[model samples]
Target chain A: MAVPPTTSRTAAELATQPACWRRAADAVPATEGLPRPGERVAVTGCGTSWFMAQAYAALREAAGEGETDAFAASEFPTARRYDRVVAITRSGTTTEVLDLLAALRGTAPLLALTADPATPVRDAADALAVLDWADEESVVQTRFATTALALLRAALPGGREAVLRAADEAATAVAEPLPAALLSASQWSFLGRGWAYGVAQEAALKMREAAGAWTEAYPSMEYRHGPVAIAGAGRVTWAFGPVPGGLEEAVTAAGGTFVHAPSDPLAELVRAQRVAVAVAEARGLDPDRPRGLTRSVVLGV
Target chain B: MAVPPTTSRTAAELATQPACWRRAADAVPATEGLPRPGERVAVTGCGTSWFMAQAYAALREAAGEGETDAFAASEFPTARRYDRVVAITRSGTTTEVLDLLAALRGTAPLLALTADPATPVRDAADALAVLDWADEESVVQTRFATTALALLRAALPGGREAVLRAADEAATAVAEPLPAALLSASQWSFLGRGWAYGVAQEAALKMREAAGAWTEAYPSMEYRHGPVAIAGAGRVTWAFGPVPGGLEEAVTAAGGTFVHAPSDPLAELVRAQRVAVAVAEARGLDPDRPRGLTRSVVLGV
Candidate 1:
């Protein structure tokens, strides 16, 4: 069987995540472009990058680090003044990010984390932190997004230890084969709490991108509100982080498989990434170049 | 054939939206609990209410009223100081809203809009705006949520005219039958731009709640980045507002039905609500009592 390029490339990139996370943690001090402890900040990105921004913003705010807001690049409120604006783009050339950075030039300090330092984002941003080592050959991003998140997480108080521990767990998680039932499930719902809500959204996006799978995500507490109606036999409800009391029982009663492993939320995301690749291979799809998608969206201005 | 109580109630409530909206618009002066023109505000809610909060926040900020943020009630950053915090809950007894209001009791002026003024939220809030007439007997909310939004929109500059126009369009929308193809589509993607993104998200939630349909929502521009991969035959892509350049062509190219009608975005949402009910009736599901859900979540403290 010919292994698709996307499968092999995505797997290889995912496997390097532990080391990438460690490097990102170590590089935090040199990366002065990140937001200061008390600075009000807005983080913008596209696709997977935007989801990571959401996680970082939630985490930063939860840590009492000051106000941090996340927005899809196109939706960033230019009228709002922030102490700093951080852009996360692996390709470093997403049209919206560049346009936003250009528009905000001289108005506020701008920082960007990208895998490609050679791209125009280097010029658009006032400062840049390049994670070239985490760059992927596949169009479906994995290492770069996680590594960028790891870099941001490390900047938070006590985040270094958490990132290191999560990296170690991710190393183990990437090795374990995805559950057959999970891969074969007719539908999936990824649930999370706090910062992990963004992780859940990204996990759902990964499944849709890599395998065209039917997937949904929601804040754990909000799942029972309406989304649970879709939960039943042949569906999987995967939770990241601790869930509200009785959630597991509720999912079970609804006839859905409830998956909650004792791992860091970020580590659980790594496992989800692995499942996406496995499902893609199983479905005979090329995740590296998903249908009707490009690595970077550089629309004509 | 006897109509399910949920369907009939939901339909009746949805049909009253035009009147509800008009009343809300007229009551803008009496709605003293709403955010002021330049006040930095945070709006919080859960489930359907949260989506409406999102729509209102975007609309408020876009109208250049002030910096507005929307958060799920459970995730609101208590540490951040806001000039005002607006809580939306039809039942007025959702535990998260009550807890949040309690937490911010002395810190910031808190406003709550609820259909049930008799509930605990009335006491928890610093001020209250009651939309008792918009309350629903059905577990699945339709009128109350949109009516609350209409109330907020009316407070914005020039919003009265827009609301009146949308209310008129909604009246026509509720009377029209849903598209045959939309009712039968195996999957659906609701897309929106700017403030309408929240409407799309709400529409997708409505489908999941009312019909247990597989649905997704995304910012219209971001859909092509990865989500469009899921678009294909038997799927529908429904846009709430004017789509970005080339989006319709892209959805069609991916073999999905692209739905865009010339109507106010809020009016378009009324059409979506009608479709959800129709689809639920076709699937023999009682939308008003969706599985594993309640009208409001009141977790024990």
Candidate 2:
């Protein structure tokens, strides 16, 4: 039997993130469907998109924009009122997203950010921000999720400059090699603080989705409570943004490799994506088509 | 050199769950600080407590009691207004809980559930529910967290009957021995839908804390997306509450051990707690004192 293609589409998609993010950042003004400064907002999605919603919610709230909440689409609180509700879906056809949008139609203004503008989400949403260029061929999503978030970040105060800088860093992150020791670690734990906690969760998800790695994620401060027990000589503890005070020492004392890079968390996530692909390749697995996964989930209710 | 006591306090405390739950159910009437029906609520905690908050939040919303949200104490959206905010901490002195309570003092009504009534949280919260009898000697929490949730559950409509039935089932769960293959599994994945997702997260945390095991948790339907790639011959996939359609078949097809007990999720959680202790005992690790963990976290700001 012949081996399949060596170059995964996930790798190709991941490599294009820096460029996609740059375009997303530049496209923010035209993407006017996002929540405004003082609007109470709820963001919803599924899987990786849900994780990105969490990151945006934390970032939006921390930036003093307004009260922002993120929820998994299936678990969204329908009774709650928000000034605006934003749904993020790479594929506009996800059942949960469509159902939620239909349920929320006349209640509040509904906005959706999707890679496909030609789907039912466009009709469901009152307004739409489409990033068709960021769509992926891989079952494992990489660029679309981050690109959507980049667009959201750009719309915030002081976010545009930061995102532009991070886009450059992401290019470097994709080109540079992942730490060999981390790639070979027996287990991986990702940690983040504030908005970065969402980044950490997404990074861990990327590793599991793209590489089938044994990975976990938690808030940096919560690591010492119990999750740190899993840290050992062959494990990796990667912090997405600023390491909480004394966390590096604790990870080192637990005999685990502590990794922190002075770059935007979004850029750090790009690095983690690269590592996931590299590790998957090393294990003779294709990152593009992860085992038993699809580009979009359309469940029959 | 002498090895300390082999019997774990966590094991002993876990065994007391059924009784503690009964007491909690009976005590719910006196627990005046719980959120009223139709009130928007936010629950906050750290570590094990946070997972319980997630479960309670899901249950509360699912019951149509109100829109309830749960957050790790540090991540609570202070800018958001809720009819009430509930903080759960086994030890009342956790810095994040104290800080959050202090921040929310004049904003709205604050309630706290803690095992230790004497701590500063007593003053920080506007109202308090103390369960001193449920306190634990073990650094790894078991009964105290579940017992607190039991009290919350009992306060909800029809929750008393459910709790009573679950208590009876919990007694059976604690007595039944966990599967030998599951106890020896190399990796574990826990899945739950809705409120059970929080139980799944807590179960995974218990395994990581008590046994230093590699564990992961996800919403049951979302498990097939990518995380199931980690499932294999030596891995375990345990589901709390009803197994989602096709999930059992998927897990079996992946060559992973599939575990689902037809019992209350809270009762299932008790079983998971037992599994954590059993795995710890097999590994010759002390569940009472997980490596580098304390009963409570008090960080200096």
Candidate 3:
């Protein structure tokens, strides 16, 4: 095999992948079966996909609509009981995920979310959701992560559609070009609030994977504790949501730069996604067609 | 300032430093200022110290005692609320942690856990618990990390005397040395159970900070998720506790080498400390005194 040289891709192309995500989201209806309000729902996956599952679980818990727990794919079924399993994998071919899906085959309903609809993980799942919006080059995930999150948002009932629309609109607002303040800074620390804590984690992981950069994520409050000392002049911080003003203030007070995504209708999450894509590009790693990595795992595990 | 040559130190010496940890056992009086059951306790430190605090918090939470939360010093009081603060610092002087202590400024009872008691953190704290064990000379912390955790075990109620006794026994047990399998492995992963999850996190962080190695920490069960797919015959897993037979069997079946710690009294954590210390030494770093580091901070941020 030849060694592949590095490359880049566009987040816009990746965002348009809702058609693929739609297929995966549609499968949820059948594969989701019927989960009781209190039924135990176990969500698992790897890398950013795992973080997405975690975010979904947090949102569900916060909404008070479901009994959900998130676990690393390797740690599932080790403790407690589950009535349903939701596995998110962009590649649809994660080996450990397949192993877990196999174990849950008879034990509970299995829902697999991925960008590659035909991968083994999808095949093993009773239902599949794919956020097919992805770049061909970058090994680290970007648009697919957001689209998958959007699909998760779409799955909720009631005001969820509103949130989805908000997220979509927010995405549009921030996508064209990140403000110079957010894009020009040398470093970033992503802070998430409550249900969005998992989002912060996923953002950090994505930054590391796609950009090979050192980015730290913490609960909004935790940042104020000690990390604030490092927030000197010119440091850039992206605050995830509005709950933790103390954290943002700490960064700003440190003579550092701050970008607060005003609580516009779905503006916060969308702004986060757009800024992340911009950061990916600023690091000289293309958001489109990133280097030496792929969107799917077709090779056997 | 003159540049000093990097020298190696033994794990035991590095771990036993008074400045590196707080021997909260009988070392401190359970006076009025001492934390009571259910009182919110905030643990803060930076980098490796923060990881140790995280492990301690997890353990206390698992033990069903202590209202515990851990934070990177930078995110402390600015992020969360606490009645009592436990600050861990190998070098009694992490700028962020010290700044955190200063910020708290008599707001809550403060306990400084450090290798050096004379440092400003200790001098300013309401009380202090010193490890004075395992002095090392490396920029990367080894023995100090484990010893600090041992000190945390002693601080929790109920098993102080017993756990302290076990620490002595366990410290002696550290004599067995790391397993041969570990010595030969090019890459290693750490897994912890229950509160030990923090240990796994610390181990992974140390690997990165000291050796610039690629490592990860996860709950024992989480490993079976997607990462296990990447596991093969050559992978070495250092499990942090006596996992259930079934979980241990799964790890073995995955074709990765599995090393289990004794559970009779939670021997995994002790052994892990020794393994980490030994590895640091093997890498030609000192377990006693790594490099470019110290046990206390007095005049700096």
Candidate 4:
């Protein structure tokens, strides 16, 4: 089966992606040649890619003008109403992504964030921002997830510049002495509320696919519903941003190991990918590139 | 390491309990002994027990005059909103169920349903519906789940006499030529919209916990966001009553199998429980007896 070739790369290979990091950092900017106020835009992706789109919508709403909405690549046509539809496909050749863009034809402006600028999805899009640079060698997503988060953060209003700065800062942090909290945990659960709930699902899906770990994602308070009964000292409960509705307290009482990124709405989009990357590295596994996986596409619908 | 006792029994055993079934059924007409309308009623249980409460709430709503809410044993206090609560502890000793009732002590009326009439939860309840007659040896929950469903159905307005009449008919159907389609190659995704989302949650939780199968429960259209993308070919999607928007066509277009329960809500509850029972029996597993687990108190504050 050729084991699908590990796309996750070690820290050493990751260090070589300065130019790629720069591009990812630049992609989410609110400068010239980028989206403007009231310019109808559509963001679409599959799995974590789509979650990044959601984080973008939330950041925009928080910023007070970025009128953006997210659509699953499969559900875009009916749900999207925009002058330009941004198609975020890492692999560039996922059957559904290609089929969707083809269905849209030239009816609207199409953009692609892909690993391969020359692949079919990018070819379908009117413009492309490639993330192939930060992609990993392992079968899971680490670099790409962070890169997508960085791009969304940069693109959100007010934080546009902050996002780019954070992306660079985040990239640097992954290589530094971040706490090794997640490495020893046997299982992980992503907790989010409201907008973050959707992100939790995608994060859980990514964690399982990338690390071969058993993970579940849920709304924070929903944990007390029965899932909390399973939590104990060694379990990890990673929380996303906007810790609304007394969710953190519920997690604490459940006796779960907890970690959080600040309440920057952008944090939720990026936290999982960043922490997972560092944890993978600490475990002596590569997060930059995963094995038998591509920076762009694998098992994605 | 002794195997846990089963709470499920054969359809034959349920047939012998016609008297208790009739009493619970006939009690519905008087409404004299039941809690007043709008009184706080808290329904608590795990897996199938939770589903039975959901069925009761739905029927109560459709019959147009009861205020009841269902909560997982762990979610009791946070979402608690009743002046009177009914605790459905089948064994009368499920650790969490007992704890949940205790947590609500003094605040509302408590009704306990148990196979053990002398169990603590029953002794604590303002009233008790003893279901000791529906005992079984199966670790899977067959007879009890169905009996709970039947009792709830009989307890609803206009349902008292009808459900009792239907119970014998349902039992006959279970014993007769019902197509034995348990564990179809098709994975099942149970969906209920709005208030029924809780029911969906219970269905997925029970199916996975009891059968160790991959099952999901979500709001009908909410599945379209991401999970639905992977659903196709070998997946069965069941929609509870009052189909949600966009679901009918979406299921068809996605190449997924779909089934809607028959018109009579009580009958639907009856049938769904039958389907679950049939699933347990076909696997040669006792639905009545769960292994290495006990029905006990689950505390929530």
Q: Each model's TM-score?
A: 0.96, 0.95, 0.58, 0.52
Score chain B of each candidate by TM-score.
Answer: 0.97, 0.97, 0.77, 0.74
Error of 1 at B48 (Å): 0.7
Highest TM-score scorer: 1
**Clash pairs for candidate 2:** none
Could you give candidate 4's per-residue lDDT for residues B1-301 as a string of tens digits?
1122334553334334444455556555543334455454557676557766765655565455454556556444433347666566566767667767777767666767677777677557677766666655444444565565556666556666666775555545444433333345236677665445555666554454344344666556445533554345666777765675556666677676777754333333344444544455555655453322223423334
Worst 10 residues of 3 chain B by lDDT: B292-301
Q: Candidate 3 versus the native: TM-score? A: 0.58
Residue B263 lDDT in candidate 4: 36
Clashing pairs in 1: none
Weakest 10 consecutive residues of candidate 1 chain B by summed lDDT = B1-10
Which candidate's DockQ is highest?
1
Per-candidate count of clashing residue pairs (backbone under 3 Å): 0, 0, 77, 66
Candidate 1 residue-wise lDDT, B1-78, digit = tens = 332344367877888999999999999998776798899999999999999999999999999999999988888888
Where is model 4 chain B poorest over a 10-residue stretch in terms of lDDT?
Answer: B289-298
Distance from true position, residue B59, model 4, in Å? 3.6
lDDT of 4 by residue, A1-301 (tens): 1112234554434344334545766655432224556665667776667776765654554455444556566545332346666676767776556777887767777777777666667568777777777665544544565465566556656555665555455555434443445656766778775456656776665554444344677656455444544354677777776554444555566566777776433334344554555455544655543333334433332
**Candidate 2 lDDT, A1-301, residue by residue in tens:** 1122347788878889989988998898787667888999999988888889989999999999998888888778788899999999989999878989999999989999999999999899999999999998888888999998999988999999988999999999977766788778878899998889988988998899888888999988788777988888989999998888888888899898999999999999998888887778878887876776778877655
lDDT of 1 by residue, A5-69 (tens): 44377778788999999999999999977898999999989999999999999999889888899
- Candidate 2 lDDT over B171-239, as tens digits, reads 999877677777778898999988899999999999999988889999887787668878889899999
Residue-level lDDT of model 3, residues B1-301, one tens digit each, is 1112324344434434333223545454542244567776888787667777877776676556655767677544343357888888766766677778888867888887777776677766787766555445555565566666666676566556645565565555545555667655555677776666776776655554444233556677555432443344666777776564455555577676877655423345445544545555566755454232233323321
